[model samples]
Target: MGFLPITKEECEARGWSQPDFVLITGDGYIDHPSFGTAIISRLLENRGYKVAVLAQPDWNSKKDFMRFGRPRLGFLVNAGNVDSMVNHYSVFKHKRRTDAYSPGGEAGKRPNRAVIVYSNRAREAYKDVPIIIGGLEASLRRLGHYDYWDDKVRRSVLLDAKADILVYGMGERAVVEIAEALDSGIEAKDIGWIRGTCVKAREIYMDEDTVLLPSFESIVASKKAYAESFALQYKNNDFITAKRLVEQYAEGLYVVQNPPQPPLETLELDDVYGLPYEGTYHPSYEEAGGIPAIKEVEFSIISSRGCFGGCAFCALTYHQGRQVRGRSKESIVKEGRRLAALPGFKGYIHDVGGPTANFRGPACKKQLTRGGCTHKDCLYPAPCSQLEVDHKEYLEILRALRSIEGVKKVFIRSGVRFDYVMADKSDEFLRELCKYHVSGTLKVAPEHISDRVLSYMHKPNKRVFEEFSSKYKKINEQLGLKQYLIPYLISSHPGSTLKDAVELAEFLSDNGFVPDQVQDFYPTPGTLATCMYYTELDPLTMERVYVAKTMEEKKMQRALIHFNKPENRELVRAALVKTGREDLFGKLLRGSGRTQNPYKKEPPLRNQKEKTRSSGNRGGQPLKKSNKRRS
Candidate 1:
């Protein structure tokens, strides 16, 4: 079949009595590697299992779920690449106008808490089918986590969706294992021994290898217990040294999570990405102008997976794990040559990066064998002494890609770790990046300026960003390039006081840098920052953190970034007055006269990886996504 069967007719064309699996998704079907639904479906098909695709089915009734009837094995459900709630709503809890994952960039195509709704619908369609749920939404909500929308602790998605088993993290390995066991006639509830899976149980024989977290009732009853629970979940994410973790929901009921599956090695990652992908959206979606999300990755190549650049608001720790993995250069080059032959092959290759572009390998040699240190981060308060910051392999891969027959330029659009760049003694990689990779402007996330806020965000201090800026400027000057650095900053993050927001505004004013996009702290699930947002205490430190909870304060904090804008004068004034820094208000707001604004217009972004659109949440892709929410 050109694409996986999305209808009963297509399934019949495949000459199969029934599909072994029906993969339900919230996104328009685009059989690309960046999509989790594609990888799992193709992998199952390659393994000789009949897999059918069901993309964004109507959720009002069970009619759409009956398109393929019941699968022989199970129903694999995912809430697209992004969390449905985050996709549908902004940080201000306002509804988003459009969705990139849907055809025609439409909104309301998928329901909120899509995994739960789809799972329930699947049950209504087939009362006795084995339902398996995984993806960014399901993975992050595998256990009891802070639900930002509900404003409280919600139980595991496994419970809410009534799923038989929940597969967390990258599901390539665990998915196959589950399929084999199910094919062997094992019940979903009994197939709980596999790694990277969570299953419900009535009783457990406690052992030294099992770590029990505080019960859900205890957490809901006490914020201290909730913080402690989050801390324990944070520490056991490593594959090598992690043990079985259990969370109690009721007296006899429990959710048991096995240790994470190991990261895929070079050849393994190559096989996963080397599957037969149709590249573009399914032909049926052409009438709707195709998926807007595919535009970002159609010309791009994923060279690696995983990240060690620990940020508090990021969900990578729970999903991809900290151990990084890279595909072989040969595999990447092969994909590039194939992309070059495609009908819409352009002269430029968009990106050749993954979670973190420059991280082609593990943080250090020790991570491969012993795993990351549970109590320490690879790059956070400071770069670890054992960090290996060589970028030779990544450079070689980029060179090979750009040298392809039809390739003109290769870009690294997935973002880079500038702190890691500074850790390297030699500036060879920096020089090359400035010379070829940068498209006039390189966007990097500095998150916040104040050391007080930076501590809570797990980002490097302001001085580190300043030094990197200086080095970047010097390197570009030597290369005779007119490049600029777009620093990504956040507002209203936990522990960010009015004084700290004023400090950030002052820094932006002094540097003549007016950022068009400012992210108010979005409290998504399975993040340290989200935990802090709910508990008002740092999960790791258990110290009380100041949270900007009120809507007025969040708006005021965001207004301070662009204080010179005439529309933001009143909010900026309020922020300054609240911080008791009224003395500098005259200097900061001096240009708020009838002259309209004082800042000059920025130069064209020149087909750069990202730019500050009219609204970062709409129109096109945003520049720096500090939070990692991929399946």
Candidate 2:
């Protein structure tokens, strides 16, 4: 019912000489379900296992790792809830000054590649004990992946960490199975048949039921091989149809990944959320200002897991898969009531949603038994005819939360899929969302306005966003609410040239919307966009794509999104001239007199052949210009 043991004193208080499992993490111990370490540790405890948390251990030596001594089962390691590379460095590869998951928001608490470092330390402390690694860092990098920080393809984290087993994805099922197997006298390396897990193999035996990806050497030597391997991994993610995958390394060494574990049913999901969580950071960290990451999730309730809205830049599909799973309405309402009773209970609940907020069930009935379509997306290109568009269950859950005692307001802070909302025939959810969930402004991601770029991102076209915007305005107007829409946009994505950047700038200008924050494309590991960025070819389609790789070009693209700002005028002008759109420079420089002439004369237009050659030399091959701007 209280916090888990983190030190030798706490372990003694529990009257245990050695814990059954020692969970070593790179984050401050926060007993919240939102934290992956908290979930796994608590799950083991509930099953009568003596679990001790060794959080943010001193990796320079084995001293801190020896605090818990040796565990009866094994040592479970994770790089906290986020990938450590993302937590330590910004998109520009600059070292971040602070870590929100650390106490006092301090940086350098955990070293680079925390999983590998901690695993090595654990091995040093007890040479023969089994070491297991999980969490986002290990999950996405279970196989050979492109490392953004290293700027090269690296071998599986399982091989590099020298850990016995690597559990990927939402790890509740996998963790329990591994624990049970280990308790039954099964060794770590021999227990390779479990789902959602990867292990190193010694032979090249092949099975007709399993899939063999490109070998590590081949993938490293050829970009095309890497793309093909990633495409196979992407398709075989669903639990229903996924096959065991094998990747070969040098000297006939291999890495074998089992199929993903099936998504939890409603009752199973309820049990995971119903664990006894302390719901706050460990008391020892109070003097260090506690964990800053808890502030965002303290009052929020996660209603669902997984996403069906496939975005190329997102890694959710590879991590959480495409199936949608939700907890019971009763479970959510109970959590909301418990949150209201917390010491600093406020009238507002920050958010009540997951990956995509409005999703309450699977996209269609067949997905429950057959899994998602491999070649097509549910909501991209266009909504499939079999897609079920209903938000009644989600709406009812929100209504129940609104009626809870001491609850004054409930906001949907997690993103809402506006395109999904538009697909519904009934407007009840939209009307009520505008009436209650609008906290003055609702945020949505219409990442870019160009059709060409949208295709590459696997996002809906500009017209879909325009239609959703119009519908949202009409509903807000009908309810007499002055709610504004704050759209999130991205810049310098693969297939986005200087011309596409200008098109997006014009869209923002015409709408009189200035984004407070703009996201430049970051090529993280295991995403389709990252593949395109690295190879200059779409993994799904082998066609060449233009990529803005240079710092100067990326800066110009980002500046164009905020062209109205006085500081960005020069960057915006330079972009327009470079793209052979100098005519738009006057429009961009109209208000700011920083340039010599507000209305610069336009140069003579180049011939079609000349324009083609000029644009091809800029980044990659030139894309066909489309005039389908949002009206």
Candidate 3:
């Protein structure tokens, strides 16, 4: 229930000569369920293991790794809850100024590739100890993956780190199995059959039931092969139907990824969440203002896991898969009471949701046994008729939380799938959401408005969003409550061209919505969209797609979303001219007619007639002659 030992003095104070496992991480040690290191270490301790944490250790030398004095079990390493590359750099590959996971919001606390660096250091400190790698970075890069930062395909993290084993996904089950095997005298290299793990093999020794993907050489040699390999990897991620996948590397070496372990059932998930977490950063960080990351999730409850809404731009499908699982309502309410009892209880429970807020059970009954459909998405193009669309259990849980004595309001900050809401035959959930849960502005991701772009993103069409918007407005009107929908949009996603950007801009203008923040498509590792960004071909269809790779084009695409801003006039104008879309130039300029141009020097105009035409047009609506004054 207390904090794990992070120093030798603490270990000695616990009357222990040595710890069982020295868990190393990139982020500062925050003993909270929201942190992967906290959950795994606490689970190990609960199972009668002495776990010492070495968080954000100095990666330059082996001295820090030796502080634990060689754990009896082994070393467990992770790049924290987020990928190291993403944590260190922005989507633009620029260095980030702050790390919420570090003390004092400092940068450069960990190395660029922390897992690889830490594992090699552990080897140097203790030559015979087993090293295991897990968490988001290792899980997503378990196989050869396209690294956007490096602009090339990199080998598996296991290979680069030279670790004995790699446990991918939610690794509670895998790590326990690994510990038992290791404690029973099984060597790390010899233990290869465990589920949700990846190990390097010296030769091809897989059984008939295993699936073989394209060799690393072949994928690196041909983009088509890489796409094909990724498709196979994506399809075989389900626990019920997945098979062991093997990919060959040079000199007869192979990386074997065992089938993913089954998702935890209601009771198992409840037990996992009920683990005794200190619920905040370690006291040592108090002097440096603590880990800022804990503030977001300090009072929130993760009620569920996995998402059926498979967006190409998201990595959840590859990491968590498509099956949905939830804890019992009793478990969630108990956590809510605990949150309400915290010292700074504000009577407001920040969130009671996970990957997707509204999802309570599996997408459909068939998925319980058959796993998700390999050929089709659960909620893309359209919701499957077989999809189970109900929010009864979720509503009940929310009601129970609200009834708790100290609880005032429970807000669902994690996004709800609006399309899923529209799929429901009843409006009870929508009404309750607007009346009780909304924090004035509900944030939802519609990504882009163009169906061409949406199709590539594997998101629901624009019509679905429109339907949801209308229903939301009607409910608000009926309740006499004023709430707004803040939609999250993306620019320069694969299959988006200047024409598509213009279409999305027109949609935003019509809706009178100017997003304060816009997300340019970032091609992180292991997502389907990242594959498309690197290959310029949809892995599913093998069709060529347009990609805006140039900085100027991407800036223009992002600028189009906020075309009403005076500063973005020149970028919008350049985009229109380059795409031969001069007709849209008039609409962009006239949408919010302003006199002051932000450009220091005026560029030459096309002609007097062009200027006159632009002044008279108001985003396709004819302006009165008296209102035709130019800036």
Candidate 4:
């Protein structure tokens, strides 16, 4: 099939007066299943709807928004794969220099709060037509959320965007249901009861089955209320157990969010991936370096969706839900074969996993029917006895991909939950992973070494990571592979203090490694950690969390983590003195500019050998551009 029309001329060439749905996005058009725009548009087209794409439109005026000439059904808007503000700025609140989603890796292509901007402009162009917003930005801010950019709690994006409805989560099921509803002649405002949607209620809403959260006014007035509100929203994310949630705005008007749509089963997931995607950036971008985001995903196959590993800083729990879903091994193998045939295929499949690489299905059998428990996490503090830890299916898919012609190596760059690997009864997956999947280094995110800080991050304790590391090394030894472990760490998380930062620095030093990059906790919407960052309270426990909010502290945390770097000596000194650990100066820093860190003794493990980084790379390579927390 030909690509979806992106302009009026293309729409006419397809013999359509107007598109049934105009998939408006904030990123350059890449018809790859990895992109939400491609997935949703293809789903609509499969249902016989004429879908047009309006990607990275000119939001300063209504001209581009009107180019589709009033979508026959409605306008579906999103701020692309990543949130726009995050896409534009770094954790230090500095404007980012490049946008992988833009045409030429340029920044500032999309406005701040892109969902609100795009929706408003679409409304300006056609005030009467329905404007439905979804994707990361809209989905995260679907309720009264703490906006880090604004440093305040803002009402739902539906109210601010003047959108008819907001679709949250993995939106395939929700968008299609809404489209069918609209096709049957339901007005957008009247279409309030669809699952996975947030709509402004015309009348005050009260129902026995629906949950009521703290009002926007209440959350704004009190941080405790905000924490409580976030906690309530987090708990009701399960499709089987969740009730319709309503948040009060004014007395008469409310925002009603229906229970999330049920996650697609295997056959349905297969169909979505089986769509006729062109598997590359739209040709219109050829002159402008071709959406840099496509480079990371073009050779990748998304074998699954959703994550059961509930990390506090991640938004997956809020967006993708805890329930896991997977495409059949046949479906993924087909995609891998197609990737091999692509013009630039070089005998490498970049990735063959999803949110969590090893998770091919739900964490346990009960989750498929009963849903994930709201009270406890799947893998945090400790793994539940009932948690089903299996990697046999994921292994089969990888083995099949490796056997495909023209495929040399299948890498698991997306990441694996080290704790989950430890929980499993079998070591077969780890041994195979060490033998085949890992390139030269297996990248795992321990996030932090301090148990105190890790508790706040909802990550496994330092011991868990250490145990996993030891096992990985043993497996690599048996396979005679000289592989290493590149552990990803985060600093200045919600409960992190200067002491915690110092502990992490010492751990890195003792391990004979320093991170090439360190991630500071960024406060974005819709995560338990973000709520903790704003409210200074663990919304889950109502206990106060120590947060390092100032830029100075954030920098100090970074200085400590990379204390071996000569440039960070002063910052490290400052951090040591401030944390009342001046004695650490001698241990953390011992020499002049030539040999800044006098190398700690190494363990017998090969991973302990330190090699100089030429261009800020850890070991094998610099992180892929698409790398996020198991994203």
Worst 10 residues of 4 by lDDT: 612-621
Cα-based lDDT at residue 64, candidate 2: 91
- How high is the CA lDDT of each candidate model? 0.85, 0.85, 0.85, 0.85
Q: After superposition, how far is residue 414 of candidate 4 from its true place, in Å?
A: 0.7
lDDT tens readout by residue for model 1, 1-631: 4799999999898787788999999999989888898899999988989999999999999999999888999999999888899888877666788888889999999999999999999999998889999998999998888898899899999998989999999999999999999999998878989999999999987999999999999999999999999999999999998989999977579999999999999999999999998887899999999888888888889888888887888788888989999999999999999989988987888888888888888899999889988888888889998998899998889889878999888888787888889898999999999988989898888888999899898888889889999999999999889898887778888999889999998998887776645687889899999999999999888999999998778777877877776556666777787788987676677755434232333233464222222223321122222222211
Tens-place lDDT digits, model 4, residues 170-251: 8998899899999999988888778999989867556777889998999999999999989889999999999888899865
* Candidate 3 residue-wise lDDT at 357: 86
The weakest ten consecutive residues by lDDT in model 2 span: 622-631
Compose the digit string of candidate 2's lDDT tens values, residues 1-631.
Answer: 7999999899999899989999999899999888888899999998889999999988999999889788999999998777788777766665667778889989889888999999988998999899999998999899999987898999999998999999999999999999999999999989988999999989756787699999999989998999999989998999998989999998778999999999888999899999999988999999999988888888889898888888898888898888989999999999999999888988899889888888888999999888999999999988889999999999999999999999999998778988889899999999999999987888888989999999999898999999988898999999999988888777899999989999998888777766655677878777899989888889888889999988778878887887876555666777887888887766776654354574554343446344322222222111110000010
Q: Could you give candidate 3's per-residue lDDT for residues 487-602 as a string of tens digits?
A: 77878899999889988888887787767446778787778999999888898889998999986687778778878865567777777778787777656766545664433335
Clashing pairs in 4: none
For residue 439, model 4's alpha carbon misses the true position, in angstroms, by 1.7
Instruction: Report the Cα lDDT for candidate 2.
Output: 0.85
For candidate 1, report its TM-score.
Answer: 0.94
Return whichever of 1 and 4 wins on lDDT.
1
